[model samples]
Target: MKRIICILSMLLCMAAETVMAARAPVSEATEECLGCHSSIHPGIVEEWQNSRHARITPREALGVTGLARKVSARTVPDYLLPTAVGCAECHTLNAKVHADTFEHNGVSIHLAVSPRDCATCHTEEAVRYSGNLMAHARKNLAANPLYQDLQQQILGRPVRREGKLTFEPPAAETRQSGCFYCHGTRLEVVGMETRDTVLGEMEFPRLSGWPNQGVGRVNTDGSLGSCAACHTRHAFSIEMARKPHTCRECHVGPDVPAYKVYASSKHGNIYAAMNRQWDFSAVPWTVGKDFTAPTCATCHISLVVNTDGQVLARRTHEMSGRLAWRIFGLIYAHPHPMNPDTTRIRNKSGQPLPTDFDGTYAAEYLIDAGEQVRRTETMQAICLGCHSASWVRGHWKRFERTIRETRSDIRAATGIMADIWARGFAKGPDSDDSPFNEAIERTWCDAWLFYANTVRFSAAMAGGGDYSVFADGRYQLSRRIQELNDWLELRNQLFPPTPPIALRGLPEKPYRVQ
Candidate 1:
């Protein structure tokens, strides 16, 4: 018994040493941080304090929670009680501890509390976010200048992205960084070397880890990120990552509007009605097998594990997951490799180069379809567990038509804009300016991004059935369209650009609507 006790103590000491050794030597102030934080936050403090963000790994930290912990011989074992992901200690930084708990408000408290604050907790997550086009403020605003143009109608005045108070500005603060809270700094942090809070305005690192939690954080040392945004810290449990609750943080906004989209999907409906059926505790989650219906992870992330399980992988944290295609774009289907055919690519090697487009046709075909058809099929299959196959098919068939029509309206709006330019009102191809003319932007904004997202999201799920239509789907859509028309007429714009007459002269382009 005495020998075992001695050996265990030695093991504990060695574990502590292993953790300490992995970290960079602390500066005097950082030393002060290490001294008190580890004691207060304990294992999680030490564990995540030395995470990839601490060491500078470009990939983001884990969003999933950790497994349960055990206390033996009065000493806590390897696992922990919902804290920051412990990198190598709890296994890689991505593993979820258990199941069903994805709300990460800890990010708001730990880092800056704004949409721009994503970098506060999801710095690495933002890279993929920027690529998503929806998260890119510049790109998204450019896509539909009207979203920004119509702000005054809803917000009553424009606010800065910084969440600052102002009269009528160019853009509202929420539109700027998707928040009305926090300073909306691109980055917020404290330098261990400088040993001080060096952000919008603060004295300490907030909750330590250099006080960085801006969603779009730009970082002080030119290194950019905010790992704490999504995965959070202090009690970063896997259960939190498993639930759809975590995504609501920023997803439920006017811009990158996912909260509305999800609320309308058939999968969302089934899950909401039958959430109890899901067995979130399972690994590599599936829809019917592990639980009952589907969740966000079922259609977006990892391959389907069973039928009702939601095993969102630890390796992915882009919010968009590792998904390739941008489905919500003007056109449907993904571009090139993001969307690929293995057999076609293999056959192409025997033929000519890039000029021989036919040679790699198969490879291109692979790119055109769903990368993981099984997952898509699995999601649809979950609906069968409740409704009949014919019922499901019939609904999608109608849905497909609605999507097509909505897309047509979008094309019509674009056509109107193009005609205005082709004639004499706006800049033509020869000109380099496509600046938002607040007026013209107002027209296009309602035509697509807003109305489009709402109607499309409504069609994607249980259409007029529930209260979805009034909540976010049609209410926002109609308002946007009305705003656009009101702005267009007020600006003396050629509404719809002489529709039927000009339709003949408009240039042709291949478009994929649903």
Candidate 2:
């Protein structure tokens, strides 16, 4: 009888809890959105239901203090405190600014949610990210004529015309799929289109760059970035953001290869072996306790803590905040840019590049040595969370050495290319022809852009095994330099610079002679 009564009491408590959860406060606007979308976008609804936004209000979230506090806004409006952050909360918050805003069921609804929308609750993160290089990714590539030319050379289709190749400019769709897919697209509300829906035929704003979620996406609201790039939409899950897989979508390509390097690293080995047992959702991610191995987030972004509740590193939305060097090899690896907008930078040659062709830095645009040292110390602090002082020091020493060594290799390749250009074998910037248009020039690009970058990333991540030795690294570097030399030598011997068509006399008739 006692056991039966206990079971009945437990059932009653469970029922009451379920009733309370069902009665959780939801705004009328959100309820209205749910009425249609719950059925129309069941997956979206399901994802939100599992999110923290659906479970807690701004009031409750703001109450959390210390390192565990995710909400950066010191206070929120009383109107927003009573209800969960739902579809309408984000989509309808800043409606006046968004050109894509349209009336749907008598409510102002915006299609694209910008970083500005998320800033309501996550103010600090939004602010920090505004100054991040990622925020200006689109402008950096599209605004620079040199980079634009390189992009065109890579994406443009080439056709053989009169024994010479001519490249046709890539179509808009091709550019969107190639570079803008990762860098970002300039989104605009072109017009409105009426669409048949479950509710009825309704008018919706037609967006130019509809499906892009690039980090630096320009939204109709005039905001610089898309929060959905990392957080994802409807769910906004931290766990998903913290995972290495989230970064792999953009960084796994040959140009970056960050994910591939990480996947093969010693840290990656540990993560692969022990990740199932790790707690990914911890607020202040404890290094040894929460996760045994470092994910991409652990080193770059997350607010990490030691076991004693001491902060190892503060969280940052500026992804390059802890980075001293920009290892992507804009010709050669240089210090990180001082400002997020690199368009203003002019090298010695008046080109909008951080470094000149000869590897001289546009020093005014790059961070000073003091700033680099500070950033390096910040990164070292994160390393100290799991590694000893000597180990960290040694690792940095090796990384610095690798940077010097790789730059030397790039210089050698650049010298050969310079000689080729001087010899009139390949057209260069001076000739007003794209340096990246010809095969040998593209091969030169591979030396710096692909192989050097791969080796540098390997050294930085301590993933140097096959990556450093064989796979598009030292081995490829040696082979490509040799190939460049061989090409120059062969061209000198067999094929001299082609004379102008007018300079060469017309071919004689083939039928001459019997």
Candidate 3:
């Protein structure tokens, strides 16, 4: 009996050891990332360098910044916090963490310290992060139209040939300094290359890996994505990711007016009004539990109970749970997964799993606007707390039309651009990073991706009244596409002889859609 008990204890010890080895402990990728990028985007990297995230791990700085200051749950280990955050906290390459060194590409690397890893710095940030959309936004926002169309436009020429509108996928630009910087950049192995300005003016380190802001990056290991972009790192505080300020990074400017439109809308007014009331540190955020706050995550990633029922805090990585229809304009979803009916989920055994949301938040992700309609219906659900649903929806519907119409115009402009090229009125394709190309890229952004969306959203949010007084309609996007058209006209005129005409409608030609 004694011998048998000893044997059982030995077996238990071995099993524990096996379990421990199977899971990755925190890896130090963030530190290595900071080492280089700090030299690049210094203005943004500096604050973080001094941040505890730079010194230790991301969790060190969680509650020390942004809306996290409002969490009201500081332990004795609190310090002054910076309201602003930068790339290193989330997009690092590697460091020594989890008592082990991981690998990137062929390089020995570390694990990406995630929200749990971040708890060390800002305990409150981690608490709030556990329940926010940004926490798992990568899982949720995959099918977002805004992100989807941008990638599609760059990779293909939009055309309506034979009364058939097909999406033709051009060869992928496949690197940074393209549509990827803003959307999200995937990290792959850094080969033994010397220099190439095209790879973000810096080489992929021979050491750590790379991660971009893409809503959901498809990793080289054939897995899904990291959730740090909007959530940031270490101190993945809900306050920081929930603030319109956070969304502004990608949503502002000429193409995506998310911040500007929200600012002018009554929704924005409420956000500003309740910024103080909106508890940034509540876990499993069920609307009433966290001061009735609603940010981007609320509409797409959060679950809210009715006013009459007891609202509890509950969050999910599955963002599509409430969504119904898909408006991913060009491709099936962002980056066009060769299969729509399937999802790429890998298991611990490293095998491709079925279309499941076990570790995936895709199921709950917003295919449309209503599945989580306890508060209200339509996209206006997030805003109806302050604005009337009808008023909010009416304005936003027009906004949606603008988004649709402008995308159509972008398709039209691409067709025209194609005509010029097909007619032999232009030269070889320019480098994707050239200033001229960048300008053209900006124009494309205005046409469908950014400015057009911004104008419509801003107008709708402001409710077409005082706040929207200065907002322009689709004119913001219309002008850019038209400008591209005009530029093409001149570009074609200056060119020499042409080959036979075979108008493909769009440049690369559209494909069959289901």
Candidate 4:
């Protein structure tokens, strides 16, 4: 037993020495970050070691073929050409811009790397993403009154107090962990806190709404988005980003239901059955060879190449680049927006459309006709990969027709609700009344937000049987409209209309004239 114990101690000592060696600085000016971090954050160190960043030195990457060349060519300051992309290689650049930068153990380091930091290397992606709705997700969600009203309704706890229904605002923990988990949370430097470390007392900036990878996360450095939301960290594998599950993180819920529709579709079945055999790591992904079925990335983001190595389409960071229509069905189906700044953009009626009405689509604003045609053609090209031109055109035609019909249904429901408000059965729609407090308002919201979105998503993806027919589709839409009309009728009966003041003053004369 004593001999075994002695052997274990020696092994531990060797392991510690190995970690220390790995942490040793490459140059005198650089910090020995790996040494401490390897001991503290072993998992991070292991992932980094396994990453292409560790394996491919800048010099080696320069000689590589395909996408690697594009990535390596963007590395600034030619001195980094011979070294591996270590912690310092990334953290050291643009140190002045980072708000969290501080002196730590004889070296200056930033706690978080912002999109601006990533822009130094990924110039094109950064620019394109800045114009994406996701970049403004946090601001839009937090700032918009209509969205806040909905948030209060959905997340807030409901209770009846003194014959009135009251909604309590959701707690900070709930907001941070729930909706903000996807929409994004504003990271703030709360102050400084002192910690008792092994060496001595050390001060560090206390932060809130951190350790998040939401697409629109407001970084401490004033950057608007988090690249790690999709690319992930350390490894940042192209394979992982190309998978459908990465998008499923936030797009799976009832409000969006994109993942659910895709997962149960014919395309999804093909992917499930055959994706294991596909070459996900290929640079210019061949459509037929690399994948028999399309993942979310294939149709939305990836560059497609033919079996003969001919480029069919280019990769895009903007997921909506090929999308012409915003079919998520908020108020109504409309054209996709030209830019992410939804607040500044106004509708034809001159109203500021709420940002990310549900999840990154607004029915109010639309792109111009030329751009819309270009995007529609781009999307149709993907359909042409496996389907005929007629099938594609027919599918889109059906989708547009469905949108028109759904809009009519919604308009009918809206008219019924407006009548209820006009008759004073409940609070006015534009009054200080909460739109979510009563059953009637919720029914109206469901008609548009839930049922309409499902039908449109089903039609757009060509997976209509279940979604459009039975599950939260046309059935739900029709039912909600009926419910709205019934509720109005019942409310009108329960609270009979009062005579107008003008009619009341002339009652005796009116009766005589009649």
In terms of TM-score, the best-performing candidate is 2
> What's the lDDT for candidate 4?
0.73
Candidate 2, residue 68: lDDT:
96
lDDT value, residue 329 of candidate 2: 93
Worst 10 residues of 1 by lDDT: 351-360
Model 3 vs truth, CA RMSD: 16.8
Kindly indicate the candidate among 1 and 2 with the higher lDDT: 2
Show pairs that collide, candidate 2.
none
Give lDDT tens digits, candidate 2, residues 1-514: 9999999999999997885595447899999999999999999998888788998899889989899999998878788998999988989978999999999999999988899988999999999999999999999988888788888778889888889886778887888887888788988988989999977899998888778888888889888988888888878999999999999989984678899899989999899999999999999999999998889998899999999999989999999999999999988999999999998988877778787777888999999999999999998998998899999999999999999999989888988887787677887765666778889998999999899999999999988589777987889988889999899889877866566222111111111101
Worst 10 residues of 4 by lDDT: 505-514
lDDT by residue (tens digit), candidate 4, 1-514: 9999999999999998886455423433333777777777889877877666666656665567774254623455677666667777777667786777777786777777777877765677787778788888887778766567678878888888999877788987788888888878888878878999765888777778876788888887788888888888877778888898989999985778888888878888888889899998787788888888888888888888777776666777787898877777656666777667655654333335522222223344568778888998888787777788999899989988887787777777777776766675665334446556687788988988888888888888776597677787889989999999998788767876665322111001100100
Best by lDDT: 2
When 2 and 4 are scored with TM-score, the better candidate is 2
Q: How are the candidates ranked when ordered by lDDT, highest leading?
A: 2, 4, 3, 1
What's each prediction's TM-score? 0.51, 0.93, 0.48, 0.86
Q: Lowest summed lDDT over 10 consecutive residues: which window, candidate 3?
A: 427-436
Number of the candidate with higher TM-score, 1 or 2: 2
**Candidate 3: regions farther than 4 A off:** 1-111, 114-206, 210-223, 283-293, 310-314, 320-389, 392-396, 427-446, 459-473, 484-504, 508-514
Per residue, candidate 3 scores C-alpha lDDT tens digits across 365-453 of 22223333432243455455445768776765665565455445556655555565455444212211111123454454444444444
